[model samples]
Target: MPFQHPETTGHGYVIERYVTRKDSDHPRYLELNGAHVLRPGWPHAKRFARHLIDDATTITDAELEALLAYEWRSRLTAAWLIGVDRRESFRERIGDLLLASEVCYSGGGFCFALARFGTHADAEILTAYLDHYLPRTDLHYDQPDALGALLHLDARLGTHHADRITEPDGLWDEWVKGVGRLGHPSHTPAELRRWTDLHCDFINDWSRS
Candidate 1:
């Protein structure tokens, strides 16, 4: 039996189950970004966006924001997947996708999604995030996803916006140190090693929660 979240529609298994199942029987689905799962199989991105907006009641404000951010990430991933398959439709969506990518919050998930897209627009969004969010002491910087996104965005976008990234204070340094281990395609081996060491600790803490 599939485990279910109360929040799930129960029309099918939740995304976690869907993704794990995709790894085996449905490799093509694997290529579909987890972010895209926000819309499932919708033919049009705008339709997908509408679905999300309609389903807004099912999720909290933070989760809705995360999903919006994830949706943009998924669009980029979909573009890449379509490009790999030589699909002409992918080209048509690129501009719209770039615009959608800007809707996400400046967290690691958002950043990772941007890095995955790796477009000029993605770089601009990442730069804007660093400028608007990092300077605020009231905002939490401890989330690994946010740090990972920043690190990956930095690696992909380079030092063009480096001056904007303030030094990590509070748990920000620890957060970056943790994400360094996850070893995204965007990171160097040295960066990966450092991140992995920190990430392991982070994971251990997360497991306890």
Candidate 2:
């Protein structure tokens, strides 16, 4: 299902305003314009990752949903909170956003949240995104992270949903061919690991502290 933005008129607009304002002080709020926490700059968001986890636990679902309707920053923040809280209800909506690829940067959050959900339904959603987007060789959205999420899901659920995608001369082939033209590597295991760990760090590492 496509993600429908609530009519941004009276109350909807207020919701948007509320979330946007709420996301302002997030540690990596400014980084929402580009790739999220797992970019080249190691530890950029690490010091404050725990604080965000603390915030995620307390934020209400209504606010998180409203944040999803706002800018990438708000959407990313909402995704993290939803994941930390394990709010599985938002899985479909986050998958919708991943497929829409409507905005930049937020796809990481969407993918991460779906992975954290760790269910077959979540895997299906990730598969759906790959089915639709991977063939579009000219585009570079969240395909890598989506693939990584599927991999994680497969490992958790004991399913091979991502096998064909990562298979030889398959959709993964198309993705590599497309990204190669742009001088980017065909695979980014390090980035994928970082993305996967970012969520784990929030859930485990922070809890220990």
Candidate 3:
């Protein structure tokens, strides 16, 4: 089902399509009489995304989306939208592309994004990414974000380690394991403790009222 946001007009439709977004606008966007137009500034990525959102009914539209896979933005857009369609092919392709990206870098916000449509294999892919790069990361947010993704996916799988959530080191041990869990190699114990607290603060209300 589409996510309901009663606060906004068009509700879930607004999140489904990227039309009203000013954040992703190309810097070179054209304006005429206060109207937004232009082929380049308004990218095909958004249009293809619309097709996915509006439920494309034609083979040609699907064909075009397949061709548009050349862009990472499209892949990211599709990765998020695939949950609505639940197309296994879309999941496989998006998951594969996302996995490739994750291998090169740590899972930050992208991990949470991937976790939204996360399947079992996607969880494994993310787990591999976090298990490898998270320990090696110096980025302050990498550990929490990576762990958040795993936790999010695990929540669905009934395997979440939220039991250990109150314990700072317990959270870290799952990802880094052994010596690095306490933040010696990449961070300090104080820092890990702060992250653990923040994680609880978020998870406490993540799916709660």
Candidate 4:
């Protein structure tokens, strides 16, 4: 029998289970640049991240392209791998995918990759994403992740690229209200940290409960 795409099953656990595999950690890639600390599955996530970064030279561009062509999980993993490796040649391709926003879940990976690139061009791509999507409050697609990426870039580059969107009553504010209506309002530091790392707190709480 042939392997099936996890998303096709329409079962979230099936998808989450797929996350533990070596090649793809969709939705979260274990922040390569994150501050080192302990958390649930931190050892597991960190190990995979280190492996990807360590073996970056061995991963061929052809392999990454194939990953990008597959489902969101593969695309997510590809983005992190590309970013960590500093594969400048793939930057445009990643940026295009980020702008397309064709699929769900993988956008976070794209954002992380672009942020890793840490170039003004990468920041522009992130800005363009927020410009186009933040106003579409009903869609709720990766706006926060893009914004987070932009802010991360700004801090690194000493640029204020994210200032306009974050102002009171600006696009970010509008998005917050919309998200709040759906009971998903928080974007605090702790909440934002989950975007980069495995949600260890969530996992611990879930397992205990």
RMSD from true fold, candidate 1? 14.5
Error (Å) of candidate 2 at residue 199 is 3.6
- Tens-digit lDDT track for model 3 on 4-56? 23223323333223322333343111111112322334444344334434442
Tens-digit lDDT track of model 2 for 1-209:
34445464223653334334333343355543344544445464555555566667776676676678776777876886787678998877887788888888889888888888889999999899989988888888888888888887787789999889877788888788988898877665345645665655546665667
Tens digit per residue, CA lDDT, model 1, 37-135: 233343443433333223322433333222222433333333333322233323323333333334333233333344445455555654554455444
Tens digits of lDDT, candidate 4, 1-209: 23245344433332232233444333333332233323444455445544555545566776666567666776776776676666889878987888888777778778877877779998899888889888877777788778777877787788988889888888888888887787776595334535533322222333334
Note the residue pairs that clash in candidate 4.
none
Please give the CA lDDT of all the candidate structures. Answer: 0.36, 0.72, 0.41, 0.65
Compared with the true structure, model 1 gives a TM-score of: 0.34
User: Between candidates 1 and 2, which one is better according to TM-score?
Assistant: 2
Top of the candidates by lDDT: 2
TM-scores of all predicted structures: 0.34, 0.78, 0.43, 0.72
TM-score ranking, best first: 2, 4, 3, 1
Candidate order by lDDT, decreasing, is 2, 4, 3, 1
Model 4: lDDT equals: 0.65
Q: What stretches of model 4 exceed 4 Å from their correct place?
A: 1-20, 23-41, 188-209
Model 4 scores a TM of 0.72
